[model samples]
Target: MTDKAHVVIVGGGLAGLLLGCVVATTCRDRLSVTLIERALPEAPEESLDTRATAISRGSKALLDHWMLWEAVSNEAKPIEDIHVSRAARFGSAMLRDAQDAREPMGWVVENVLLQQVLVARCEAEGVALLEGREVVDFCATQENPKLTLNNEEVIDADLVVIADGAQSALRESIGIGAIRHSPSQFAIAVNCETDGADCGVAYERFTSEGPLALLPIPNGSSSRARYNVIWCAHKVKQAALLKLSDDDFIGALQAEFGWRAGKILRVGRRTGWPLGKIAARELVRARCVLFGNAAHTLHPVAGQGFNLSLRDVERLATVIATEAGQDAPFSSVERLSVFTDMSRKDHEQTMGATSQLAEMLDSPSPFVDGLASLALSTLDLTGPIKRNVAEFGMGRR
Candidate 1:
């Protein structure tokens, strides 16, 4: 077995790339790092899968650390306000105005743009990226961890991080157990153009169909640039919804969602994905660890899916980098413990928030709607509680 590098990452997605960027910059001369991805890297192009993320102050801080924030800041729109409402309720709850915390709750960014920034940084940091290569097998022992690539190359390193994604074959190969639950629903995502001034706000409306989220995108001149939408509905309803023409779809959306953004215009093609959750029974061992979706997959109720994974990537990179800096036992059990402890609180909190919201929103009964209204109203009334909730959801405090 070859034993030259200290760390090997098994995925090239956002989480893997972010971890690589952080580790590459911090441990450049000390540790050797390599990243393996199954697909070739490509530039961002026009696609119907117009997914976007509400990056919290915390996420922005992490990105700023590597100096990539400025590069992609132009593609983001700060969410100065958030309007949340229940379809059954007469009035909506507002989490805006000053004193809504110290900053504009969070910034919304396109997924394609974010990916482009991360990929560029990874390349700039001199990370050894092996594209079109796959991890066919991985075996971790007490002394060393080894990975076999599809290119017939084998690598033995002090630590191996599996970031292959939610359906991670690495997780399965390692004999790790995870709980998978289907929420009996699916999310249809699309991008729509609006004819109004961009208010720098986000809207989330809960209906019997599911939760529909509208996030602002950066369009310099007017709000007409476009907004990203994720409409969750039952599997049976998805087909009919997707069959509507763009104009008819906008009319349907307007009926459900009022003129919050003035006039809604063109909509890109929509893509549907099943809603589910996956949480590994355990996330760490002696010399191997799981980060990103490999560890947990939450319902995308609050757009915390990728940001939560970024937090994991950051924490794991810090733990591993600090361990690499020390002279004592490398990849020791204690090092793994550090990762476990650091991520325990945040992971539990995020999982609890998203899972609870999913369950609460899934029930379309009047009672549930009343409960939802009361909860939001209470959150708006209580400053500390609301701030904490916002911080947890925005990946900041």
Candidate 2:
């Protein structure tokens, strides 16, 4: 008789829950899966928070496999066009039209809504989700992977996947080497109601202050559109910006954002996050592996962090399922290396783009700005460059 394989996943966020669903659905009666999370799977209200995310085509494809896309697509708005510009007149701005890619570029999502959908799907698929519990320690032997929770319950499995956040305690416990770099900028995020016409466009404007990204939000039949604003600036300036009255802050945002869309009214609370990147040197060892922020994190300049994590989860699931079907050692070093290879290209591309973009925006030299201006102008007229960037950003190519 075949032994029942058990899989344990730590962290109940998007990555963790989605991974659980994949295993439960693909493996079916072959594997038993359990997910542990510190927060209860509570329903979220309709109000928006500082929590927002962008889902790329790659991630959408993974969700579609599970028939979960419809759950989220309604809450997201397609980014039909994106305008990238600099605050200073010295630099040139580039416009990337989604039509060039023959598909919607991506969808901007609210975090709570994403969690609700994933949690519901996991429950329906027979993935055992344990809430109000945290993993206190994790140990992986050549034979078994064991997780001890704060409540003193222990779970042993044939494989363990870690989806914990960047500062993952379990990752540290497992001796995963990670490198971190501070971006020296903080992101201020808010949901706003526009007092003007609705335009299904996104903006990624870089200024001496920092990058300000305006993402479109879902609106009803009304012609007026809403947007989620994320502004990156020096930490001190971020604090001052937060202190401004709602109307005053809107005025400041309008001065930089222009009247293309109309007046911006605050619709949700504003929150801030320090910008940085963290990457683990190795994602897997023996029967244990890491995913999500536990493996890597990126600055929100491109909103690629969570999307990267989702890619990791999706590929990992595919690798394991393929190996299991062949009765091969899916958690073996050789098989896990396959998963690593799949992520390297995308991760490297995203890292390179974000780093280059951030450095160009932060640089003070006139020569560097001139070069950036030239590159922007060249990219506009260059169809290959524009198409390649759009495909890369959407995870299509």
Candidate 3:
């Protein structure tokens, strides 16, 4: 019905909404974008998620370029340093910005706040918001991809983006298989307030039982040290953790994580979920492509999941914008292949690093654990190595 190429995105989670905003902002009037989401709007504070995500420097750069950084940073807390240690071990790694010394490595924002910002920006950019509707079926590889809603209404698109969750039926129906790489593990997330000064430092503690992470977060108008915790464990340990009282839980976490950031005075509600890695066997096919969790879902050991997805969004936006009005949108499998190839390195590197860390620390070999402890110490003392690791965490790679 219009000259602009039609691009239909299915899903409205953080990934889906952010992709819509980034693409709309990049292509402007050159593309017509529509988002099909099933969830209706809710009160801002009544969130579906209570967890927070770390945004790397590379991701911040993309948002900065797109002029959306301010909205996110307004509610984000900068992570100035990261402390890595092993439970009851001698060696530790204190990672700081020794390189370019640009801005803080990254920032942490609540998932709810981020969704609010992305949704607002998406609306402001004039992307058609076809919310409160579900796509019952989709055929994304045709000359003109088609989406059928629950109401049996059909819509055609020159290109289709699938940003649905990791368990995406649409991606499976379209013939994309996933490679899951993870052991039997689960994650428990909780927020806490500290009794000591927060030095804008995040912590990653590796224990014999599991790995635990604590990221800095905003504490409203108060100056108290607030944090979001991510604790990973096997089934039995996970069950034990969930069964503990709040006070006992804090005590157990304090014992595992130590007092580098001071005592864990109090904790908020806790959430738990099974953890794993899910990567699509193929990222693109003809006019169809996968984005966000639909393409890859990762372990939170390294806090790279959402940031990696944002990087993918930026790359796709630039590529799609470049080809707009010059080619038949994403109708070319070759063009989509270019995107896949260009993004492969980052994906492999990020996903590999996350998986390795989780598996390495969870190894049953005492020798490997000793070596990992030594590596942490060596990295801390080795200025160059520490700098490189810090930058990698900052998303420089």
Against the true structure, candidate 1 reaches a TM-score of 0.90
Highest TM-score: give the candidate number. 3
What are the candidates' C-alpha RMSDs? 2.7, 2.7, 2.2
lDDT per model, in order?
Answer: 0.78, 0.77, 0.84
lDDT of 3 by residue, 240-300 (tens): 9999998999899988888888888888878888887798999888778899899988889
Over the stretch 134-185, how does candidate 1's per-residue lDDT look in tens digits?
A: 9887877537877888878988778788889899998888788999997577
- For model 1, the superposed segments whose C-alpha errors exceed 4 Å read 1-4, 40-49, 97-103, 141-143, 220-223, 326-330, 377-385
TM-score of each: 0.90, 0.90, 0.94
| Span of ten consecutive residues with least summed lDDT in model 2 | 41-50
lDDT of 3: 0.84
For model 3, the stretches where C-alpha displacement exceeds 4 angstroms are: 40-49, 99-102
Candidate 2 structure lDDT: 0.77
